[model samples]
Target: MNPELLIAFLASTAGAATPLVLAATGELVAERAGVLNLGLEGMMLVGAVMGFSVTLASGNGGLGLLAAMGAGALMALLFAFLVLTLQTNQVATGLALTLFGVGLSAFIGRGLVGQTVAPLRKLAFPVLSDLPFVGPLLFRFDAMVYASLLLTVAVGWMLARTRLGLLVRAVGESPHSAHAIGFHVIALRYGAVMFGGAMAGLAGAYMSMALTPMWVEGMTAGRGWIALALVVFATWKPRGVVLGSYLFGGVTVLQFHGQGFGLAVPSEFLSMLPYLATIAVLVYICRDPKTILLNKPLSLGQSFRAD
Candidate 1:
């Protein structure tokens, strides 16, 4: 392949992976704290619409992202109240959250359906962005791309190195012990859930404001499900999430590349490639129960009561 084409492919792969990385990382954090937030799809949808609307109205990408985060957190708060406070079933509440987000986003974005906003521009590092080959491959992405990378690193470091990380993991592994040791399991889970929501929202905003810059019904197209699968694929590790996101991103981009190469297959099949790949990967990872039991948070999806 020509250098230019290779660079473009690499760039697109990073862009494609950014949202997944962001959303999966957030889910990783929550799961590590013993909270299973299945409302990621809903949160991403709400964030995408809200982010686009806010950016269009305010002409500020940053504020739009903030709005998206706020919207996501609010959605997460509802889930938290139900699952944590009311002690409702996490899986059911999460499914309901996704349904709510889909309908609510469609209603809110009805008028803004065809509208567009200026896509966020790439941030060129002074000398770095000008280098041969390396510049386009590394330094030529928008802020969110870089933010996702940093977020992954930060989460990994925190989980492996910090006291707070230890507490979060402890809560996920065994809330009773964490609580016995004076950690507030409920409150910590709340913070983790909210953080996950905020990240999912930002992932949605990235879709509207950066990736596509327009609103459409169900625009997330099950990326939220992919992100959930990624958390499992990564074995709940932050670094694994990054690798898995990029791997899936490559799978997504390969469809277009395949078409470019003059493949005879229908475009629809190409489109299904990513989802197909997701299922394959999940089956491969889950075929062995020991692999899952060793990595999965022990108390995930379980409600904890201080009493």
Candidate 2:
């Protein structure tokens, strides 16, 4: 590949990594608070359809994006209410949520299967976007790309350095202990879940309105599931999510682009790479009981009721 092509490929990889980065980081936060949300996939699909629907009506991508986030958060809040407040099984409730989102999005987006969207534009710094190879590599990216990277940093900093992050960590480690220390464990988990939902929604909007630039039924595919797996790959660390997401995105993009390089492979085979990679990573990460005991959220995928 030429320098220009290489630069473009890297840029595209970064762009493709954005949504995964956002989604993974958000999941990390929620899991850190001892709330495992498997509804991420469904939440993101709803966000994509709703984001596109709203953007079409109002002609405002930003507002549409905000609406998408809200939509995801609302679903997450519902899950929180069911699992946290009602003491339902987190895994079962989350799976049901995913099913509901998928059906609802399909129904509402049936009419929007073939529609265009004005994607969010990237802002390039003056003189920065014109620099040498670095320009194309870094400066030429959509707004969401920057937002994803920044969010990773912000969430990582919060988890590692801030008071709230410490509290969130404490909650994940032991809700009973946290409550003993007067921390509002359930509320903190709720907040974390909602934030995760918002991020997942933004990721969905990026799919419908940015990556594809059109509304498509089930456009998110299984990206949300991959994001869920990404939390494990990141060891539930916010910072590690950034690196892990890009690795997955790179593999995903490569699967399509590999054909361009004249690799003799079936398209279906390439399509399977994303999910396969996720399974492989999850197995590797969870293979060790000690590692999970040390790093995995102690109360992950568990229901907590304050007594």
Question: Largest lDDT belongs to which candidate?
Answer: 1
Please list the C-alpha lDDT of all candidates, in the order they appear: 0.94, 0.87
**Residue 115 deviation, candidate 2, in Å?**
1.0
Off by over 4 Å in 2: none
TM-score of each: 0.98, 0.96
Give the per-residue Cα lDDT of candidate 2 at 185.
Answer: 94
lDDT tens digits by residue: candidate 2, 150-206: 898898889889999999999998999999989999899999999999998989988
Best by TM-score: 1
Name the Cα RMSD for model 1: 1.0
After superposition, candidate 1 runs with Cα above 4 Å error: none
lDDT of 1 by residue, 84-199 (tens): 99999999999999999999999999999889999999998999999999999999999999999999999999998999999999999999999998999999999999999999
